[model samples]
Target: MDALDGRLIRLLAEEPRIGVLECSRRLQVARGTVQARLDRLQAKGVISGFGPEVDPAAIGYPVTAFATLEISQGQGADVRAHLARVPEVLELHTITGIGDMLVRIVARSNADLQRVIDRVVGFDGIVRSSTAIVLENPVPYRILPLVDQAAAE
Candidate 1:
């Protein structure tokens, strides 16, 4: 990724609805150049998708929590499949730490969170689990700084 790519990405991140022609105009590049760069970025998996960002809170599920799960021996696949079946399980990660897997879950309220947690760890493959509720999200997910650093390189 070059400086132009970084600038283009920053512009896109700010205004996701902007078109290629407008991006080219703002970046002072040809429309085809902008289009080609975007295509290349997508093909290389740098630009994953152009879909609208959806907030779980806006959709009625406001509470957020993380679950650390320790599964029974050789039951990783089964545990993963089981967790994937739950709608509230937003993200899952296999980690090298106190737990075998980490899951990000959401719920409508604190009471609803217990039900979600029960369903999450109910599978026989799961041996033990721990959970922590998110008090606040001072820094949500972002990648712009990395993008700029890559552009600098």
Candidate 2:
């Protein structure tokens, strides 16, 4: 990874659908060179996968929230597996903070959100839980810093 790779990542982060020919033209490099670099990046897992970003509201789930979960002794895996089965749960993460797991959920409305939370809190070994509803999502997602690319030759 190098300046070239950084440039490529920045461009792709903005537009993952950009073609190799367009990338080469923008970077002033040969098409094959752009293709090779992308292949190498993917092979090394620096570049994962790409896809469209959809709105949860447009998909019928208008409500979004972050849930902090506290589990009973030795119930982390059980709680995690239970959360995974729910379609409303968009993302789940284990953290070192006060909570055992953090979950992102989307629902249709307040009633829907309550239902989802009720089901989640009902899971075995779940001791306590809290939620913060998202009033607005200003910056949802962004590309990670390309440290390897920063140190490239």
Candidate 3:
């Protein structure tokens, strides 16, 4: 990624609806150049997708929680498949720690969260689990600073 690509990504992150023509106008580059850069970015897996970001709170599942699952030996695939069938499991990651997998889940309420957790630990392979409810988000997820740093480089 070069300076031009950095600028283009920043612009897109700010205004995702802008088309290639508008990007070309703003960046003072040819339309083909903007289009080609975008194409290359996507091809290189830098630009993953143009899907709209959805808020779980807005969609009725406001309660957010993280769960760490301790599984029986050699059951990662089975546990992962079981979690995949659950709609409330938003994201899952295998991390090096006390637990085998870390999962992010959401629910309609506290009672609903219990239900989600129950489903998560229902499988035979899961030995134990730990959970923490998210009370607030002081610093939400972001990558703009990294993008700017990359641009400088």
Candidate 4:
């Protein structure tokens, strides 16, 4: 992506509600140019979806936890399907190391977390599971810095 594209992304990241006309005015480009850039970015999969970022904590799920699952051999797909049915299972990753899969989950409380974990490991393929509760988030998830670095390059 070029400097203009970077600027457009940064602008949108800062103010998602802004229109193409407003973006053109702020970036000093034509409305069509802004529109075209946004369209191209979406087509290229650089900008995926414009969905609102929801906070689980704000939605009554204050507790965040990560669970590592050791599944039976050749049961990754089955385990994944099972986890997909659970609403609290926010993110899942096929990880390397001791664990076969790592899942991020949220719950209303510590008691509720146990129930979530129970559901997560209920599948027959899951042989063992370990959980680590997140106590704090000093650095929240972000991509702006990476985006800036890419723009600089």
Q: Positional deviation of 142 in candidate 2, in angstroms? A: 1.6
Better of 2 and 4 by lDDT: 4
lDDT of every predicted structure (CA atoms): 0.97, 0.87, 0.95, 0.95
Query: What is the TM-score (0 to 1) of candidate 3?
Result: 0.97
For candidate 3, write residues 55-117 as lDDT tens digits: 999999999999999999999999999999999999999989799999999999999999999
Give candidate 4's root-mean-square deviation (CA, Å): 0.8
Return the lDDT, model 1, position 29. 99
Candidate rank order under lDDT: 1, 3, 4, 2
Task: Please list the residue runs of candidate 1 whose C-alpha ends up more than 4 Å from where it truly belongs after superposition.
Answer: none
RMSD of each: 0.9, 2.5, 0.9, 0.8
Better candidate number, 1 or 2, judged by TM-score: 1
Q: Candidate 4, which ten residues in sequence have the lowest lDDT sum? A: 142-151
In candidate 4, position 21 carries an lDDT of: 97
Model 2 residue 122 lDDT?
A: 88
Q: Which digits, one per residue and each the tens of the lDDT, describe model 2 over residues 1-153? A: 788888888888888789999999999999999999999999999888877778889989999999999889898888888998999999999877798889999899998999999988887788899999999988767654645346464
